[model samples]
Target: MSMSVPVVGNFRQVPEVAQAGCRITERPENDLTDYAQLLDVIDVGICAVDRTLCIRSWNAFMAAHSGYGSREVIGRPLFELFPELPQDWLKERFDRVFDLGVPSFTSWEQRRYLFSFPHNCPINGGVESMQQDTRLLPIKDELGRVVQVLVCLFDVTDAVLLHHRLAETIQVLEEERQEQQQLIARLAETQEQLIQSEKLAAIGQLAAGVAHEINNPVGFVMSNFRSLEHYVEGAFTLIELFDRHIDVLPAEARAQVARLKQDMDYEFVANDVRALVAESRDGLERVKRIVSDLRDFSRVGETDWQWANVHACLDSTLNVVMNEIKYKAKVVKAYGDLPEIECMPFQLNQVFLNLLVNAAQSIRERGTITLRTRTEDDHVCIEIEDTGAGMTPEVMKRIFDPFYTTKPVGKGTGLGLSVTQSIIGRHQGSISVASTPGLGTTFTLQLPQRHTTAM
Candidate 1:
């Protein structure tokens, strides 16, 4: 009933077995040849062994690969020929096969135990290794006995190597993607700075001319006030003399003077003169402030950082650019209270200055420029909204590229937005512009209220 033929034989009789001698039970008298032929055709390495652990059906595929022949290996103890098949493992399962006869299986790939066959797996250049996918199954006999165990092995080096390569490739791609993202962020910030700088330069040129024009009117008014003050002082002195000498005049003359004084309301004149002088002084002060702001606005100097009163800078900038906005643009200020920021104040000044002017410029003759500010987290936000010509989406996309002027060739440096962005970058801030063709454009600046130390 045993599916495995016993390994008993006189090697001299069967030429195939005789060529190599074995030392176990006799081979099956019937079907011995058929078993030998079947071993050659199975795809994987296959071998059969009896309950005694003797090689029973040695296939050409298994025998040829293992350097063992039918007669020489068949009668040998399984451990003698292949120690990779441990004695405990071989006997334990083989005893089960001989006793209860239950079939069993194994999918141990390239795992080494104390077995002759496991060690027999060849390694070129003196380094040992094994096929990665191997399985073993038992063959049952008619009496419900596992008479033989069939072992199969497969090579799986390709799959394992491929997995490692794929993981490495993915890691490299992730690094590249992160680097690309950083590059884009830096590019955007740089473009913003360039555009802002250009805008400031343009406005600075314009402010210089306007400040001069305003200062002239202020000069004449100041001179007129001084002259008026001198003449008014003389008038006061004469009135005082009359007041002092009135008792000495005749009653008639004194009475006449009294009537004149009552008609003139001398007390009112004295009180009103002081008020007029105060008002005039205040007016002159306003003129002086305007002149001073204009000077600050026209700060065409080296680019560097400074602690600046952002509000003051913006006020002066607005005043100097007033000529550009006075008649056509309705200006609104929604400013917030904030501590002065540490920055390239001149450059930042130029940035906002340009933004305000640009907002005003965006509008056609007679529009609006709304300037608003708020504290945005740790930074300040300045929003400049304009009722201007606006722009199409396509134009907006390339607006920050150098030489991308929307204004006429002679008019714009095309770097206004780019420069603004760069200034923001140096301060670790951000700027964004949004617009609708017919509606208007809004430029927003989110600036860090304080300077940051480099890590």
Candidate 2:
């Protein structure tokens, strides 16, 4: 005989089970009993509740975890058997499933567990109870009217635990990546500083050598010029005395002397000789001053910190770079009374040179570079202002970054401002720039009157 059996979400007819040790070719009449036996051995937690919330069916997985046999839970109200379950919430879910004849799902992420079963696995020690993902499946009869709701529970404790571990691992890796980026930035700054120091040292040596070579010839030239001036004065005095006594000479002799004087342009020659001597002397003095300025600006072997006149430093550096600026822009120095400050003079000179050259180069045509210096409290403030092709906001933001420049390639190394900033920092000072596109730029420097340990 064939019989009907209710299994999970569907109803089916099947042949009944045969008696043990007997082979029967025809169908038996106990199919529902066979279906019930099949449901008991399944691994998942399977249960069905009716419209009144009474348990209609329970499987072995449910009995094993809840410690309640099928006979104990079957026919009992589901809430009565497990008082820990959220009664109103679960009832609402069941009502929705029954009314809609549809399925609903809940995962471990939203709601951890439904049944409150103890964790069965030994390795997931971090979790105290089993995590579950549940499905509410509606069951209907022949007319397609919803009768009961089947609840299927899946054990997802391991997946949830693994997810937590993976999140922690990712957090640690992200922190490490940020640390490495910071380290790389510091290393690049150190490398740029080293390169700038080497270049400054080489330039200082060359300046010192040139100054020494020029000083000797300039000294002797000035001395000989002074003696030549005296000799010319005596000769002109004797010529004046002879002119006063010219009436004492014979007629022929006097005529010969007159012809010689006219031919030689004697008065013009004497006057031009004195003027030429004055001009040559002035030129030599300028050469001598340039050599002296070069020596002061470089201070090659004077790397040790010492008390230096700030005005003197600026003047020497300005002279050293005069050729670069004289044609491009007019420099106006507004000096203020400032006390000597302790510093590495050569390094400070480099800073001045860099800023001045940059100010001059910024001007496309003739412009003004005004240098103003003054003492304010314990600091010396210097401003190098230029009426030049100023920078945009974007360019100003990155002007101090190493190898960042707007100058044409091959004309600039882009490290000038970067190295300039570094030098100022080494003296425990600060440098800042203010620029307006198409207007001009001003670089302001503040140096402490007293030296302190550099950062």
How many steric overlaps are in each model, in order? 40, 1
Task: Score each candidate by Cα lDDT.
Answer: 0.68, 0.82
- RMSD to the native, candidate 1? 16.7
In model 1, how large is the Cα lDDT of residue 56? 62
- C-alpha root-mean-square deviation, each candidate: 16.7, 8.3
Q: Which candidate is the best by TM-score?
A: 2
What is the C-alpha lDDT profile of model 1 across 1-455, one tens digit per residue? 32432345542234333222112224455534533454466645655566667766566656665778766776667777776655676577566655664444443332432222333444332324433454445565435456565555444334444555777788999999999998997788667755665765677667767878888888888889888888888888997997888798889998898898799997898989889898988978777787777666566544556777878778877876787789879888888887778777767776877787777777777888888888867888888899988899999899876657778878887766766776678789888889999899998888887787641
Model 2 agreement with the true structure over 29-100: per-residue lDDT tens digits: 443445445656666688888788888778878999999987898789999989988788888999999899
By TM-score, how accurate is candidate 1? 0.44
Q: What is the lDDT of residue 300 in candidate 2?
A: 42
- Candidate 2: where is the Cα deviation over 4 Å? 1-160, 228-276, 300-303, 418-430, 451-455
Which ten-residue region of model 1 has the weakest summed lDDT? 16-25
